[model samples]
Target: MNGSVTSQDLGEIFKPIVESFGCELWGIDFNNSGRSRLLRIYIDKTERPIDVKDCEKVSRQISGVLDVEETISGDYVLEVSSPGIDRPLFSIDQFKMYIGSKISLKSRIQKEGRRKFNGVLKKVDAQNIEVEVGKVDYVFPHSNIESANLISDY
Candidate 1:
């Protein structure tokens, strides 16, 4: 993809391919800051736990499409995998799915001198979510979240 291409664009490009494997496109993470760009595709299947074979299958297909499309201009590492236990939450709907679960998140901007929060997910709405850390409740706008993931006990 070009510099103007966003994760959303990548999502559109890859969603069909992922779904063809009987998986949901959980999310896409493209990191270009490092020496080598990394494109990570997270896939999920409710019917069964994803295995190595599943990832390999998706990777091979995606790689072939990427090569043919030349979506990415330069060399980049492509990874296709399950979200695992501590799955990253990429959408408001995802957060809603894990209500009452423990979660940790980093915000793009500090709130009350804190940029990181680890807490129980209390509530989720269209615009924001409420989390309880200790005895205090914090509300975070979805737009401010840089990253968030469920906190797994296992």
Candidate 2:
């Protein structure tokens, strides 16, 4: 899969299958690396942590579905796993959940001469999020965030 295959597209195709196994589709990461593409599906459960069996079960189900659907253009590795403690933040709601927690993120475009930010997520509203990096507070539009992950202090 190339640029044509989006995370959203794959998420739509795989979310139902993931949910069927009593887990939530935390996020999907599709990396197009020339001939060797990698597709990673992150699964989560509110009550407890996901185990190897959960990963195996979801992997099998998704593998079968992908084989049948043929949505991808070429050969790719499919990995199903939990979004660990340093889990990626994909949506605004996901960010909201981490309020007052530390996060490391990269912005698509530089803001105030900086594109990278590592600090506590101070606030989240409808359009933007505030991060307190050092003593300065920076407000970044949600759309500008290229990638964000919760910081595992441990």
The candidate that achieves the highest TM-score relative to the unseen native structure: 1
Error (Å) of candidate 2 at residue 66 is: 1.1
Off by over 4 Å in 2: 1-3
Q: How close to the true structure is residue 30 of candidate 2, measured as C-alpha lDDT?
A: 87
TM-scores for every predicted model = 0.96, 0.93
Report the alpha-carbon TM-score of model 1 versus the true structure.
0.96
Q: What are the C-alpha RMSDs, in order, of all predicted structures?
A: 1.0, 1.6
Clashing pairs in 1: 1-71, 1-72
